[model samples]
Target: MHNILSVSELSKTYDSRFQALKRINLDIRRGEIFALLGPNGAGKTTLISIICGIVKASEGSVRVDGHDIVADYRAARAMIGLVPQELTTDAFESVWATVSFSRGLFGKPANPAYIEKILRELSLWNKKDSKIITLSGGMKRRLLIAKALSHEPEILFLDEPTAGVDVNLRRDMWQLVRSLQATGVTIILTTHYIDEAEEMADRIGVISKGEIILVDEKAELMRKLGKKQMTLQLQTTLERIPPALAAYQLELASDGNELIYTFDAQGERTGIVALLKELNDADIVFKDLHTTQSSLEDIFVSLVKEEK
Candidate 1:
């Protein structure tokens, strides 16, 4: 796959001696939704800001579609569109007017048809004549996205696109993102929502303390670090684990009615046969057994904690 955006040895340092970003290197594949995951102040915004030319990097470089952000800033910026976390729009401007004006800002010729399509896609067509202030909070967020797409950018960067939005609007925005992906628009988003990353991202990138800690396909990441738990419903209560089962990592749960055995999914063997044999020897009877895999949220939390 071809990469639309590339960052090499990117670093950012503020005057206050704060290092916002370390030696970061990343490549965003063409037409893939890449999610950057991190806690607050983890340089998610700073990385996007540098790529979009909103904030200058202290070191290293960024290239958008083969155009260096610094040397060929115009060409690079023209290939990208950014929907900021903040909602800053003209209060009195009509929806149509605001969207149309955004297109002109990118040196794009006026295209009423294109503007209309975006509004209709975002379900903002009915409010075309309504002033921005008259619209709801959700509408304002949608309008920001409209303005970002008004210029028909090839690569769209969404910064916490669903933050502070309601459930319905969040679902709507996710649908909108999928629609854009269908049109071959590359999307890179930074979000605190782990499930959003799990559901939408083609690849996940984890950053912490000004460093790029990990990046991999969502499924692969899960498999490599994922653990599974097998829960057994005991037929009778037991005072403690037998010495024969002490070799295995197990926990008693459900008030001693359940026994939980945890093992790595990526391991060569789950040791179920050994555990069953040992249980039989100990006269332990399980009426039911069920298994569960670790979720993305669990993996994310563990990674962050390990990094910290």
Candidate 2:
């Protein structure tokens, strides 16, 4: 896995103030679905805009597939496609016409067969002749995808790709993204939907306040940042934890009917055996025990809040 896109010391300033982005450095591996997660005003879009050449960075540089975005603007941009959050399509244009023109914009030769393939793949072939305005919200989003793929770009940037779509459509979009990845097309997406990143990303990156907070394999990040909890249902209610069990640092919950123990998920030793033995010596009886691991959403929310 080699990097397909790289941003180094990329900084953006608006009107000499309002630094939308700081000295951000990131590399997106080829053929991986990388999800950029952040809160609003977190500079997710600003970073994407710089990579896609929609906005110029006031400082630093970006490279797309080894070509400098500034020096090789045309060659670099030719390999990328962007599906923005807004539905900024011509209302009167037919689906076929709109998609066809997008490919032409890239200086690619006309290929109706390719256009038809993408349309059918998106379930938009039948609506090819329909006006953009007549299509439903789901259809319009799907149409936007079709247009983005029209030029057969190697790298696709999906900015809030499933914003207002229905559940079924979102499912379809995920399937479609996988299908594209199978073709060796690298995808970089910015999504407010935490589940979308949890469900689709191979690697996840967290950006907060114009800086890159963390980037790691989705599973690794979860394992490293996530906590594991064990809940013990006591046979009898207690007013408070025993003073001798203070070393365990357990919290009494459920009105003292239960106790919660938390530990690192990635730790080699959970100390459960010792804790249980101590509970027995402390005359603490448990009715049952269960454990749970933290989720990506929990980790994400915590990170953003910590940054703030």
- lDDT over C-alpha atoms for residue 66 of model 1: 93
Highest lDDT scorer: 2
How far out, in Å, is residue 98 in model 1? 1.4
Please identify model 2 stretches exceeding 4 Å from their true place. Answer: none
Q: Report model 1's TM-score to 2 decimal places.
A: 0.96
Question: Could you tell me the TM-score of candidate 2?
Answer: 0.97
Compute each candidate's TM-score over C-alphas. Answer: 0.96, 0.97
Judging by TM-score against the true structure, name the best candidate. 2
Look at candidate 1 and tell me the lDDT of residue 264.
Answer: 82
Model 1, 1-308: lDDT tens digits are: 99999999999999959999999999999999999999898899999999999999999999998999999998999889999988777799999999999899889999999999999999999999999989998989999999999999999999999999888888888999999999999999999888899889999999998899999998899889889889999999977888789888789885888999998875426588889889999999999999999888899899889987
Q: What 10-residue stretch in candidate 2 is worst by lDDT?
A: 264-273
